[model samples]
Target: MNKFELVFIPGPGIGHLASTVELANVLVSRDDRLSVTVLAIKLPNDIKTTTERIQSLSASFEGKSIRFIVLPELPFPNQSSEPPPLMLQAFLESHKPHVREIVTNLIHDSNRLVGFVIDMFCTSMINVANEFKVPCYLFYTSNAGFLDFSFHLQELYNQNNSTAEQLQNSNVELALPSFINPIPNKAIPPFLFDKDMAAWFHDNTKRFRSEVKGILINTFVEMEPQIVKWMSNGSSKIPKVYTVGPILQLKSIGVTQSNNALNGADILKWLDDQPPASVVFLCFGSKGSFDEDQVLEIARALERSEVRFLWSLRQPPPKGKFEEPSNYANINDVLPEGFLNRTADIGRVIGWAPQIEILSHPATGGFISHCGWNSTLESVWHGVPMATWPLYAEQQFNAFEMVVELGLAVELTLDYVKDFHIGRSRIVSAEEIESGIRKLMGDSGNEIRKKIKVKGEESRKSMMEGGSSFNSLRHFIDDALTNLQEGNY
Candidate 1:
């Protein structure tokens, strides 16, 4: 049997790395002639956790034709004043030479280097892939709706020379093909309000259009049918688009033997005591955290709602530090006085969450989420409806999609951007939080719950043989093999 090798370069974040690794597992499992080598990038902070997770994935897939190789850590950049998007682009650019060296050795060892599957943030590595005469595919960690919005923004920049300042200053709604309703200006990603970040996104979108052989999105057709249909249509401006996902781990990873394991067991046991579909799960993504004021509001809301709940509350990292939010040393220090005791019988609060396990539990009725793409997919996979409280990145847009387009969630605050110096620009009041929680857990949520239950069934079916995502994966693999036969790489 002839052998083919593909190199994967995932972003430094855990969410990005996990999805990329899952995609690699899908590829090698489908085709015995193919193998994947993942080049893991080291994040400056939380190096230990990332390393351990990678180790765990490797161990879980022992004897598989997948390899995990950690790249040497580069010195942290000194440009503190630069916008974060530019800083990240420069940091990844510094890895080009290291990547070239590794790819060179892989080829010299008689491996038929076919392609490079790179994270969306690691687009700088595309130049290296070009140098090695291999095709490059972008593994977009977000949904197709967000990808379409990005392309729309880039088109506006190209055709009308629109600037971030102009977009931020105007209050116009955009009627993009990807969405059913006109997207309001407030729904745009907060990062795009900065001039430097807007330009960075424009450049990245240009590369996505002109450089990549294909773009792989982490969404299934049933989730975003209209947007997927629009992109997959024969369009000259867009590259080949593949929707091969709901690509997530079904079981929990990297928590079996750590402190988290004990915590996870307790949380699961607590859930076991609750009746089926009785608990509302509130968890923000890894970077999601809040100030004392916001935390107090959530606590009050949970108490007033009187619903069984599991809340994962994390403390923000100290100012001027490049670190993730840590579990509160004592969660009570920030929460309302006597709040834990008052809600003891009905709810539990913890630091880090074993999200997959919690969502899969029969007791989980609804999710109060930050609307991260990974969390959104996981919620759908487990048939849990959501209430959106988006904080950063493209989450605001995702919230709009869930509430307006798909009707899969209720809205808490679609455009809540956290200000590091202070708190949110406008604090979401406790009453508002309580209203959302009640709606999500009460009879008002029946319609949304039914929609999500059906969507969740479709999500699973999409991964089965002869389903949309399964066929999409087969199509992607066929294209890669065809390129190899044609000597196009």
Candidate 2:
């Protein structure tokens, strides 16, 4: 019999691509009869970097049953002005014909195309899956709480007939389900302020969940049980939910320099010099960069905090462009005078530090992160606490849950609009940054460390045989098999 082949469509970024590949790896590893074909989507402005990262991930899976096929980059119509949600929607919508063709050919060849596992951004593939008469599953790359929040917002909007402007501007303290405390408007995603994009996303999520077979979240039940419970309560249109993750195990590259642009030895050597759990690794996600003023303040904060640090800093994005510049300028140009030299003994600054490798190192203790879901999970997996600095997307919600609900991180700032690039004169002051770092690195962080340490153990256990996440995946596979035998596909 032919192996069960599943098609996975990932959104356009390293985080989405990496997590999707990891999930695929888990699927095939769990069952020899399973195989996955990842359909990579190219992002608009950052095509080169994105493709390079995807290629690296594919190479890492060399002997594995997973394969990658990249889709063409979406053509930008008025690319200068379009937001991410709209750009993503356009890309997925425009590529529907291509996806349909691919699926049709696979069916014609009699491949055991059991299901379509698609990224949340690529929900447009649901129609193509329906057309091909296969089950479609949504793979959410973030925490379950973020997923619940999106649906809750949608439900609230629907029930209240609230305008996007009113909802965005309202100082409503919501006691939303799936969370322990009330959620403030400032902790919501900044895109909600954009009336059109917010409406589009809300409607798309509602349709996507209602239309798909189920959702596979990249989270374990132990990490966010409340949120997972809320998601699986069957109140939403999504029929089933699976928590089969903390699934970010990158195959060993075997003693070479890490794939990030920086040298692995240099990063490791610096960490080696520090005491265990003493150094803080700072990195925003792929798209994270700071303005000159914010950069200087970070330098000042690092200097004042007197904590050992490694910063993976980036230049701010070019105007009307979302990608990093091909070349980097000197840090001296942006940092305060004598800041780097004075902190040289305690801090190491580099561009694009190998985040996962560094996080796994014993010398690394805390993370000052953008709270991107991928980073958050990595931090937890390594048993490291975080100083949360959410930049964009659902990161603010992730930070809120980490700090307020899960008790895993310290907050630098939770204001959603403050860190955004659009005409914001306020910079998070050096004093406040220094204070947050001190709190994270000091004895006060002991409880958070203990909590995350237990979580790390639970994360590992969840993937073991008979564990919650392990059983969840097994159940999903069995259900798919039953449906196949019943001719449901």
Candidate 3:
């Protein structure tokens, strides 16, 4: 039996890199004959911190069947001037030659290269996998619902021969089976509306559904059985898709920054003093932020709801500018007048909170979240129900799935973004935010909590030996081995 190395090409972000590395860890731990090398592309703004975090994760996985090769930072002269999605695309495009070199050397050294696993953003790397006659698998860092929608949206456009302008202009709700509710026209991500971006997404979805060997989603069968079932059985377009996830190896990998001022001990201690399931943990994802007015509205909402809360806030980026983690600032300057003083007993506002550790706290009964896929999984893993407030990306779809399909969350308007370019979303008024807060943390939230608790138990059980997620991993390994032995990859 020969050992195999799977080359993983992760997009430039902590979220993408962490999930991919964790997946690699699980794959190697499950099969002793497997190893992985992550080709990490460094983004211009995140080079320093991303490097440090990856170095830390690499150290923790030391002596294990995992290693990392950080590709040099791409020389993007206009990095400071471009948006993140565009910047990330440019970085990945520039690093192709480097990735090709690494993959070629591994093969030349006679390493049994079983497959090439790529993050969703790095779908273009399928070409590299094809060039070397290796199978390519997409490691989706989000839920199966998002993946299903992306595939369906692509097919919808392809079948209709609809232009992006027509799709954007139409008021038609997408009738996707993955969602119990139809996706509102406005709730659709901007990428699907822009001609060039839609083309890029369609191209990738085409490759993923037809050309890619498999898709590894970061969700469990129990958490999203409907969508998972649809992808595995109902959809003929989607290739073999596996739910080998709730792949949270961040703790084992120790991926957090050690220098954060938000002391985990103090936060946990406060939670310890609170009644069980009494506190609502509020956090947007890493890049999530609100403007000054929005921050004021949030403060007012929290104050009105009178719920015990813990908020980890990042300063809003400048108009039309992107801000990195290193740029996080205190919230006192932007919060409403005397807001901190009034809510002192009810809430703790910090620059950054250790999210995983916080969510695991006993006092955290409800979560007010941006509905980022990572945050959604983390909250579910801890049995915390959510008040879904999505900011951007596929988060709106994730929110819809949680509230409608999965019956796990309360919604804060899915049409929150009225305009993407001008950042002119309908401001979630303080009253509406307060209502959502009350609904999630109050007795009305009991059903949602009950549902999430059951799913959380299922998540834990699925990760155990012979469990759904564990078996899914084993099945994927078996397929890879068969492909290798048959000389089909």
Candidate 4:
């Protein structure tokens, strides 16, 4: 193939888009033969109605050698106090016609339809790929633990007694690997264990397994052999499974600078002031939020920890605000009283910080994260340790994997039930916060630093020319093209 073309799909979050964009850049740079297009597909809708539309940043991806396509125009998923998962299914049903039309066009125009390295959440595409007789590759952006956790969601739900209440009542420690302690189920994202979400996600995952070409994850096989083997060996006709990642491959291709105006957020300016390896960078992945109480609890924790920090606290507006759904909305100002003033000298708070740069700064030593996979990978990529406090989805599992399996994180848990839904207040007391912060800041800090330092080097090496990710990208194209030549498409 003289020029290879592939389409990438990402959910409506920044991390997924950032990584997908990185993948496209790397693929093109690695081969004169490759050109990749990105088709944006929102899980429910892209933004919470309260925040400013993300259009400015989204528009910047209109770059040379890359084409941007929005998942066909579809009605925004109906919003309610309902969990986001339910809204997603409703959104898909409403957009089915538009989705079908786009798929038809894509399949018709493409030459030998190579393969789709899709956000595994876009399950609807499996049908279209199969209809076109092209291979569909499940591109799992999260870690192997999440894939393993999500894979069991359907089975747990099918047990007849595993209701949301049951998952809530049970402990994750017992449900998951033996090494970690239990966390509340509600802290997990609304995506897992909810029957509707499980049905949609798992069915598509299962279909993709049965009918698509193979599984390609953004994690290396050595890092997750048990799950990888179970995946490749489980299916009767499993497509080949390839693991190569910590996918920051674009950095190797010199795709570091963003010329977009939004880069003016100037996060690096703030980082320059902090002492080397002294600031704990705190930010949950975009799309994550905390309840009022959790917000105050974090404020108290940070204040008590007395660790210099840079924090980004951006949460979706409470469900009721979506009723009016306008651009300028009452979103920020969620932090607690005297919180900003008390910590002003010790920490910097922003709506959103340029994360990669902030995490990479020499002044940044550790992270207090929600354990979102991309954040986990990015922190590891930059050689930073974490204070793992997961709040949702399979993140709880990733936290476990990091602390128990990888030894790269210090798991901080507040193992108690919260009275309210968004969980701002239900956290460790001020004392625990102080201790947790200290553990990651001093001599213990250097020890954790050494462990993660090697990981960053390994992560970078894995995507370089002779690396696993580099070679895997090559194999991906050749396999798809050769299969197409044999009349697969």
Number of the predicted model whose TM-score against the real structure is largest: 1
Please, what are the lDDT tens digits per residue for candidate 4 over residues 1-489?
Answer: 545567666655556666777667666666656666677655434444211223433355445466666655465554554555455555555554654576567656533346677666666666665665667777778876666665555456556534455565545433544223443453455444455555556665566556667666788654565666666565524567666677762231211222221232355766777789999877776555556566677778788778898776665555643321111123235667667678878886665556777787899988988787878888888988888777656666677677766678876652332212333435556666667778877677677789888877877887778876667777876787787778757
Model 3: residues >4 Å from true position, as ranges?
Answer: 77-84, 169-171, 250-261, 325-330, 418-422
User: Which runs of model 1 end up more than 4 angstroms from their true locations?
Assistant: 256-262, 419-423
Location of the lowest summed lDDT over 10 successive residues in candidate 3: 252-261
Which of candidates 1 and 2 reaches a greater lDDT? 1
Question: Please, what is the whole-model Cα lDDT of each candidate in the order they appear?
Answer: 0.88, 0.80, 0.80, 0.63
Q: lDDT per residue, candidate 2, 200-296, as tens digits?
A: 8788778755788778889999999887887788765556989999888544332333223447777888788899999988898777878888888
Q: Report model 1's TM-score to 2 decimal places.
A: 0.97
- Of the two candidates 1 and 4, the one with more favorable TM-score, higher being better, is 1
lDDT of 1 by residue, 1-489 (tens): 547999999998888998999999999999898989999988778688888998998999899889988888886576465665677788888888888998888887556889999999999999899998889999999999989989988988998665687778547688986678998877888788777778889999999999999999999999999999999887637989889999997777876422223388888999999999999999999889888888888888899899999998888988765568987767769988899799989988888889999999999999999999999999999999999999888898899999998899998888788743223657888999999999999999999999999999999999999999999999999998899899877
Off by over 4 Å in 4: 42-64, 93-96, 103-112, 152-197, 225-238, 249-266, 320-339, 414-425
- TM-score-based ranking: 1, 2, 3, 4
For model 3, what is the alpha-carbon lDDT of residue 31?
Answer: 88
TM-score of each: 0.97, 0.94, 0.94, 0.81
Residue-wise C-alpha lDDT for candidate 3, range 317-397, written one tens digit per residue:
556545443324555677788888998887888766778877888888889988889888888888999998888787777
lDDT comparing candidate 4 with the true structure: 0.63
Q: Is candidate 2 or candidate 4 better by lDDT?
A: 2
Error of 4 at 284 (Å): 1.3
Screening candidate 2 with a backbone cut-off below 3 angstroms (N, C-alpha, C), the clashing residue pairs are none
